[model samples]
Target: MTNDPLSPQSNDSQKRLMVALALSFAATAAYTFFFAPKPQPPGAEGADAGVVLAQGADAGTAEVAVPPPGNGGTAESTLTAEAPPPPLRKVDVARQEAKYTFSSEGAGLTFAELQGRKMREQQTLTIREGFDKLFGKPVPTAPQMNLAHPVPGQPLPLSISIEGNTPLPATTRYAVEEGTTPKGAGTLSFTGRQGPWEVTKSFLWPHEGFELVYTVTVRNTSAQPQSGELRVHYSRAIDPEFEHAPSFFGGVGNLSRSACWIDDKLHKLSPGDKPPEDTRGQVSFFGIDQQYFLSALYPLDGPMAGHCVLTATPTAREVAAGFPLNVGPGQTATFRFGGYLGPKDPDLLRTVPGVALRDAAGLSTAAAFHPKLEDTVDFGIWAVICKMLLAVMKFFHGLVGNWGVAIILLTVLVKLVLLPLTYRSMVSMEQVKKLQPRLEEIKKKFADDRERQNLETMKLYQEAKVNPLGGCLPMLIQMPVWIALFTSLRNSFDIYGEPFFGPVWTDLTYKDPTYILPLALGVSMIITQKMQPQMMDAQQAKMMTWVLPVIFTFTLLQYPAGLSLYIFTNNVLSIAQQYGLRKWLARKGGNPTGDGTAAVSAAGGKRK
Candidate 1:
C-alpha cells in the first residue's frame, strides 16, 4: 500500500533516472547540432534552401550557367530541365502601324502583325470576287502579313542567349512590367532570373513606322566573373503558304533569305547556298529578307563588332548576331537594338531609330547611332534604274493618289524621255522601207555572194543617211527600262500592294490573278509588232507577230502586273503616235512619209 508499490526501489530508481537523463541529453544535443545554424538569405555560406543563381548571355550570344541549389555539394554550373517551369504566356505591344507579339517563355518575339491600309496580305479572289474585280466593284482584302512566325521547337525570334552560358532556360517564365514610353508608346519589360544570372528585355513600341526599339540587359549577381558570346536571335518559320521559290515562269515570289551587313558589305544566303566560314565583322544589321518584307535588327549604337550565324532551310530562315562580353560580379551588360518588321520600303528603312528612341529608352542621345538600314531593300544590278523608276512613280503617286495611274504616268514619262530616239528609230525604219526593193534586187544580183549582199545593204543604208542599227535603238533603250521596272516591282515596296483599276490587278507587284490583262497585253503587242515595218523575212516576221506574242503572254503570265501595264500602255501610245505621224505627213504635202501604215503600204503592197 505504500509508494513502493507505484515506484521502484531507491537503487533501481537511481539507475532508471540516470538512463532517462542520458536519453534526454542525447535528444538535446541532436536538436542543437541540427537547428542552431540559420539558412542565410540566399548566396551566403553553408545555406541549404535550394535557391538558384544564373548567368544569361544575349541575343544569339555566348554562354550562361546556373549554380547548384544547396551549399553542401557545389555542382558544376549548368541548366537543368528536371524542374518544372513557370506558366508561359504571350504579351502584345501595339502601335499605330503594328502589333508586336512576344512570348513570356523566351522573352522574345512570337510574331508581329502589321497594321496599315497598304500593309495587308495580297488579296485572294473567288469567282464572285473576280467578277466584281472585273466589273469595277470594290475588291476585298486579306489580313495583314504576320512576320517572325517561330517554328514549333525553334527559339523564338529576338530571343537572347549565350553561345556557351545561360542561367535560366531560354523558355524561362518571366515577370512582366508594363509602362508607357517617353513618346507615350506602350512598353513591356520582362525579367527572368536563375542562379546568379538575370536577364531583362525591355521593348518600346514606336509612335509610327515599323522600326521598334528594344533594350536587353544581362546581369551577373555571383561573386565570380562571367564571359560568353551574347547573341540575339531572329528566326522565322517560313510558311509555304506565304512563300514561293522563284520558278522559271514565276515572278520573284516571296523568296526568303538570310542577310547580314558586315564591314560595309552585304551577304545573303538562300536555302541551299553554302555559308561562310567566318561571320565575324563590324555587323550593322542581320535578319531574314523576303523580297517585299524585311525582319531585321540594327544596333542602336550603329555598327558594332560582332559575328553573325545564319540558318536557312526550306521551311525556316534564321539569323543570330552578337559579340563576346565579360561581365564582372554585380555588373551588367546592355544591348540596344532597332527592330524592323515591315515592308522593305526604303523611306522607312532609311530612318533608323534616333534621339527620340534613345531618350525614350532612358539612354543618352549624344552620339546616337545611325545605321544604313535602307540597304536591305537591294535591287542588285538594277539599283540605279530601279531607284529612278521608284522615285518617278512615287512622285506621280503623290500627285495622282493612285498607284495604277502613277504607273501609267510613269510609262508616259519614260516614253517622253526617249521620244527623240524612238522617233528617229521610226524614221530609220521608214527610210529602210524605201530601200527594201533595192535590197531585194541586190540580194538577187549577188545570190552567191553573201558578203556582196551585205555590202550592198550597207551601201543602201548609207545612201539613205540611216544606220541599219538605228531601228534597234528603241528596243535597246526600252530593254533596260523593262528589266528595271520588273526589278523594281519585285524589290520596291512602293508598288507592293497597290492595285490597278480593279481586282484583276489587285497587287501591282504580284502577277495578275486573271489572264485578262496579260492576254490583252499580248493582243496589243501583236498589233504593235504588226505596226512596225517588216524588218525581217516572211518567216521571221510571222514568228515575231504571232509566236512572239504567244510566248510573251506566257512569260508575262507569271510576271508583275505593273510591268505588263506599262508595256501595254506604251504600245497603245506608240500606235497612236505612229498613226498621228502618218496622218500629219499625208496632210503636210501628200507625201507618203508616214511610219506605220504608209511604210507598210509602200513596202509590202506587192504581197497580194
Candidate 2:
C-alpha cells in the first residue's frame, strides 16, 4: 500500500528511471496497438497473402487472371482479344471444408466410424476411406475416404477384395473357416488351389493387452502346384498431401511440413518418388496440438502407447524393414505382425507382444544446454533441484481443482516454506543497506584506489556477516521451477481455453487479446522490484528498476496469460512476505527503522 516502494524510483536516481520506463511503455503500446498490422478478415479477396484474386457477391465463380489463349500466364493479357467470360466455376467453399476426412481405412478392414483429433503438428491419423472392393485392380485410385466419427454398435463399412493378381479360379467356391484361438483373430477358408485356401484376417478391435497374429494357408488344387510371387502389399490410402512426407507422419517443429511414416522413419511423401510430381501423400500435421502426441512421436516404439505423452518431430532418415517372407503353395508361410492406430499409451503398448515400439513417451528429446557454459555453470544442479520443487508444486496441484488457484497457493506455500531463508537474506540485505553510508564514506576516503575500496567492501561484508549472493540464491533457486512450470502450462492441453476469472486469462498457451493480465503483471513487477532495497550503482539500479518490468511486460504480452498471472501473483505475494519479514527483523534489531524501506535488521542483510 505504501507509495514509496511503489514509486517509479526512490532515494536513488528516480526521475531518469521514470522517464525511461514511461517512454518504453509508450513505445511498446504504440507498436502493439497502432503500428502492428491486424489479422486479415476471413474469406476477404486477396487475403491469402494475395493468393486469392477476387470474391463474388454470389457463390458463383469469380474471374481470376489467367494467361491468354496461347500463352501460359497468370496475368491478364491486355494485348490478346477479349475472350468470352470463362464459364463460371461454382466454388463451394463450405462444401469443400466439410467434404474430406483426412484418413483412409486399410484394405479388408471395416471401419464403423472414424474420429480424428489433432495431437500436434505432425502426427494426425484419421479414418479417411472405408469400403468393400473387388481387388482386381486394387480398386483403381481407391475409394473415397470418410471422416464421420465412429459410433459403437454400428456396423463398420467393409473393405472387400474379390480380384487380385492371384485370385480364386472361376470354378472355385469359398466356404468360411472361423478360428476361435485368438480373440478377433479369425480365418476363413476358400475351396480352390488343391484343397482349402485359408484367408486369415480380423475385423474386430484387438483385445486389450493382446496382439493379433494371422497365418494364411494356400493349398494346391491341381496335382501339380504352381509357383508364383505372392506379392503382399500393405495398402493404406492416406491423405497424399496430408503431411507432405508419408514416412514422417508427424511434421517437424511447430510449423512442420506434411509428413509420411514409412517403416519407422517420418518423411514428406510427394506425388513422385523422384521429381516433377508434387502431389504429397502426406497432409500437413502443422496444427494438431496435443501434448501426448508431441511427446510420444519420438522414440515411438515404447511401453507408453495410449498414454498422454508429447509427440516429437520425426526425423527424415529412412527406417529399416524386416526381412521379406517366402510363401509356397500347399505349405503356408505365416507372416505375423501388429500395429497401433490411436494415441500412444505406454501401458497398452507394453502389454502387446511384438509391438513394444509404441511405448516411447516423456520429454527427453529436447537437447539440454546453455549458450554459454560460464553463464550457466550450475544449471544441471539447479534443474534437478527445481524439478523437485515443481514436484512439490504438483503435489499441491493434485489437491486443488483449479490450476490458477494452485499456482497462487503454490507461491504462498513456497513463500511460507522459504520464510526463514528469505528472512536471513533480507537481514543481510538490511545490514548492507545500513552500512551503505559507511561504504560510501570508505569509497570517498579511498576514491583514488579501486582495489582498496573493494577490500574495504569485503571487510564490511565480513564484519556484517552479509553474503552478497544471499539475496540472489533463493531467487536463483526458483528459476528452474519457473521454467518447467511455464513449459508444462504452455504445452499442457488441460489448460487450453481453461478460464480463470473472466476472459482476462482463458488460455494458458495464448495471450489475452485484451492484454489486461500483462498490464497488471507489469505493474506488479514494477512495485515488487521497488520494494527490494537497491544494491547496484544508482544509475544501474534506476535503469534496471524500470527496464526489467518493461521487458517482462513485452515478453508477457504474447505469452500464455496464465504465466503472467503467476508472475503477478508472485510479485504481490513477495511484497507481503518482504513487509512481514522486515517488521519481524526490525523487532529483532535487524532493522532499526521498523519500516521495510529503511535500513534495519541484518538477519537478512545485503551481501557485502
Candidate 3:
C-alpha cells in the first residue's frame, strides 16, 4: 500500500509463507508416494514366532532322549564314541491362535519337518533343518544375522508353515531327499500326520554376510495329478508393525529405474507392460513380520520371461500366485525361489536372481553420478579431479591397513596441494581486516543508501585485489573431497569392524557410543572458529563462535565415530593453521584488534 515496493519485513514474511507451502506440498507428496495404502497378502497371516522350551519343564527330568550303545557298550568307551547331543527343542503356545514348533534332526544339522506344513512343490526330502552345505560339505553352524533381537531371558520362537495346499498324511516318515546321495549320511525325514497340518523345520546359521539357503526336493507322492494353487507361507519373530517395512527384508537394496548390464537393446518390458499369455505366471509373496518384493525370470521359449510383484503394504493378504501349474502323474515341477534374510551385500546379491539392493537412505546410484552432468558449473570438473584423490586414498589405505589414518593423511595431502590457494586466501583476509577501519568509514558515509554501501565495498575490494569470495573458493573446493570421503566411509565394508588405534574406536562406519570423539570434535571446532577471521556482524560472529560448534558437537554425537574423529582431527589441524596465520598477520602490520574493524559503524565513531 505504501510507496515502498520492497520492505524488509514484508519480503521476509512472503518468503516464510512460500517456504511453508513448499514444505507442506513435499510432505504430502512423500506420504502419498512412500506410505500409500498397499494391503498385506493373505498368506502373511500368523502370530509371532513362538518360543520352544528346553527338553522338559521340570528340573532334572532331562529334555532329550539318551540312547544306549547297540552292540559294544561299556563305560570305558571313548568320549568321541558317544554320538553328538540331540538338537535343542523350542515350542510356544499362542492363545486363541494356531500352534507351531521347529526342531532339528541332530547337532550341526538343520531341523527336520516334523508333523504338519508341507509344500505341494516337488523338493528334495532333506530334514527341514537350518543348515547350509558349502563346497558340498555340511557347515556345522547356524544362520548368521546382521542384528539379533532375541528377547533376553525369554524363549525364542520357531516359525512353522506349509504351502501348495499339500494334504496332510497320517503318521509316516518319508525320505523325499537325501544330502549324501546313495544313502551315505545326511537325509531329510518328513514325519506327516493330520490336524491343522503343522510342520516343524530347523535352521542353521549362515556364513557371515551370506544368507542361509534351504533347498528341499520333494517327490509328488500323491497318486492323483494334483495342480491348482501353490502357497509359500512363513512366520517370523518380528511384530506386525514392522512386517511390511522394506528394512525388515534387507535395507539398502539395489533398486534402479534402469539396468546397467542387462540385455536392454531389444524391446524391453516397460514398467506397465505385461508379457505374453504363456509368460504371465503369477507370483504371490506372503510373509509374517517380513516385507518383500519379487522379480522372476521364467523359461519362456528359451532364454527367460521376467515377471514381478512388489509387496506394497504390510496388511495386503495373499497376492494371487497367478494360476496353478499342472503336475503330471508321477512327474515333478521344480519351483525355484529364494529368501534373502540379511543385510544387502554386493557379493551375496549375486546369489539372488534379481536386481541389486539399495538403501532408501537417500543416495541412489544415479545420484552418485549426478555432479558429472547436472552440476557442470561447480562440480563437473571437480568430480573428475576427485577420482584421482579417491585413488590416492585407496592407495594409502592399502599400505597403512587403517582407513582412519588414511583419511587424515589424505586431508593433509589435500592441504599441502592447496597450500598456495589457502595462503592467498589467508593473506587476503588479513589485508581485508586491516582495512576494516577504512571500509567502515565508507559504510557510515553511505549508511542510509543500501546500493552505495555495496558499491563502496566493491570499490574497496577492487583496490585491495581481494575478491570477497576468495576464502569461499577454498572451502568450496573441499566440499567435493569431503563428500567423496563420506561416500567412501559409508560404503566400505572393510571398515565395518576394522580397529583404529584400539577399542577406543572400532567400526569407523558407526557411532562411538562413549561420546569421546564428539566432544573432542566440539572442542576443536570452537578453537578453530575462534582463530578464524572475525565475522561482519554480531549475529554471524555468534553463530560461528558458539552456535555452530555446539550444533556440530551434538550432531557428531549421533554420527559414526570414525567420521567424528576425522572431523575432529581436521578442526584441530585447522586451529593450528589459523594460529600460525594470525601470528604471521600480526607481524606483517595486520590489525591487532580481533573485533574486525571493517564491521564498525560511523554512528558516534562506534566499533561494532
Candidate 4:
C-alpha cells in the first residue's frame, strides 16, 4: 500500500506475495526443463547396475568420447545423466609371472593371478596320499595364487576418485585403451571425465616381472577452477572361513593385511584389527600384503606428503592413497605411481628399476624409482638377527642348492661360532660336579638359614673358579638364532614355499602336515637333556626332562617344519658334541664316559 501510495510509509502486501510466487514458479520451471526425469528410450531400461556420473553435475562435461578400441581394446558406451548403464567390459594384461584383468566399469584390476612353481598353493593331502608322501611319493602342486581372489564389489584395485568441491565417485566408468608397450611390456590406458575434471589412468606392465608403472592425470575441463584430493583405492575380499589372523605364539596365519608406509615407518592392519588413527605423512607405498605375496602401489617419483586411509574387516582389506590437488581451468595435474604385485622377495623388492627396467615400463629413465617395497616383509622385533640368519642361509643355499641343507649348515655355523663359549660352559659344569659333594654338605649345614646358604654357594663358586649357571649360556645365545629363523620362515619369501627333501616336509614355511619331524625333535631333545648334567633339584630335573619335552613337542607340532627341523638337527649335533666332551674330560682325570652317572655317584659317595 505504501509503494502504491508512492513515498508514503506503506507498501501493498498482495503485490509482494504475487512477486514471491512468480519467482518460485520461474525456479520450478527452470529445474523441470533442465533436470526432470525423462522417459526411457526403446530397450534402455533395466537394473541400475553400471556406474554413472553423479546427478546435478555439469552434463556438458559428463562424457569423454573414445575412439573405437582398434588394438584389442573394448568400445565402451558413454555414461549419461539420464541413461543408467553402458554395459561392463574388460581387458587383460599378462606379464611373465602375473596376469592382471582390468574392468572397464572402474578401469581397475579385477584379478591379479600369480603364476610359477613356488607361488603355487599347497594342496590338501588325503590320508592315502599323506602316507605315500611320507614314504617319499611326489604330490602334484596346488593351483596358482590369486592376489585378488574373492574380488571386492565395486571400487576395485587401482580405482580413482576425486573428493572436494565437485566430488566424483569411484564407480564412474572409463573408456579403456589396450596396446603393447615398449620392451615387450603390456599397456592399458583408462580415460574418463565427470563434472569439471577428466582423468586418465595409464599403466605399463613389463614383459617379465611383478612390477608395473602407473600414471594418473586429472585435467580441469570446466571454465571454472576445481580443487580436491585424488584418491587411489585398492581392495581385496577375503573369506574369513579360509583366512586366519597371524599369531606369534600360534602357528603361521595366512590372512592378508593392508599396509601403508607413511613418513618413515610402515603401518600394517590385519583383519579385525583397529585402523591407524594418524596416517598423514609422506607416503612411500601402500596395498594388500598377503605375507609371502604383495600387491602394492607407491609414488614413482618417491615419497611425498599424502593422506592414507586404511581399513580392515574379517572379510576385506582396503587402502586409499589420497593426494591433494588444485587445478585451474584447462590445467592438468599428473601423478606417477609404481606398483609391485608378486612375491615379497627382498632381492626383487629391494632392487629399484634398473637398466633392464628402463625400457620395460616406459618409466622415466627408471632412475627416479626408489620405492621401499621390501618393508612389506615384516621381520618383527628380531630384525638384525633375522637378516643375519637369512644372509647365512642364502649363502649356504647358493652353495648347496637345497634349503634344508642350508639350514643344517647354518646350525653348524652357529655352533662353531659359539664353540669357545660352549667349551668354557662344559669345563665349568665339570668343576661344579667336583664341588657337588661339598655343596650338599653346605646345604645340610645351613638347612634353616636360606640367606646363609646362598652366600656360601656364591663363595664356593668363586673359590672353585667355576660358574654354576654356565650351562645355560649356550642355550640363551641360540635362542635369538632360533627366533630369527622362525621369523624368516614366517615372512621371508626366499624360504616361504620352498621344499625340504620333499614329501611330508613339503613346505618349510608351513607346518609339517605329518607329526614325524616334531616327534623326532622331541626324542632328540630328551636324549640331549639326559646327556647334560642335571644341575637342579629332583623335582626341577623331572620337570625339565619330562614336562619340558612334552610341552616343547606339542608346541613345535603347530610350528613351521623349518623350526622343528633346525632344533632336531641341532640336538643331534649337541649329543655328539657332549659325547666327545665327556671323552676329553675322562682323559683329563675328570668324569669318565662309561657310567652315564659316574660323576654324580662319585660325588654322592664322597658326600656320604
Best of the two (2, 4) by TM-score? 4
lDDT of 2 by residue, 291-407 (tens): 222111111122111111112233211111112223343345433223333323333433333221212111132321111101111124345554454466557668876667766
**Candidate 3, 450: how far from true, in Å?**
2.8
Question: Which scores better on lDDT, 2 or 4?
Answer: 4
Write down the lDDT of every candidate, Cα atoms only: 0.75, 0.41, 0.41, 0.78
lDDT of 3: 0.41
TM-score of each: 0.81, 0.48, 0.50, 0.80
Give the local distance difference test score of model 2: 0.41
Over 95-175, each residue of candidate 3 has an lDDT whose tens digit, in order, gives: 111222333321111221212111111111122221222123342331222122222221221212223555322121221
Off by over 4 Å in 2: 1-291, 294-398, 490-499, 591-608
The sequence of per-residue lDDT tens digits that candidate 4 reaches over residues 367-397 is 5667778777788799999999999999999
State the lDDT of candidate 1 residue by residue for 293-408, as single tens digits: 88888888778899888888888888878787688877899988887788877776665664455556565656666677788777889999888888888899999998889989
For residue 121, give model 4's deviation from the true position in Å. Answer: 4.4
- Which model scores highest in lDDT? 4
Worst 10 residues of 3 by lDDT: 369-378
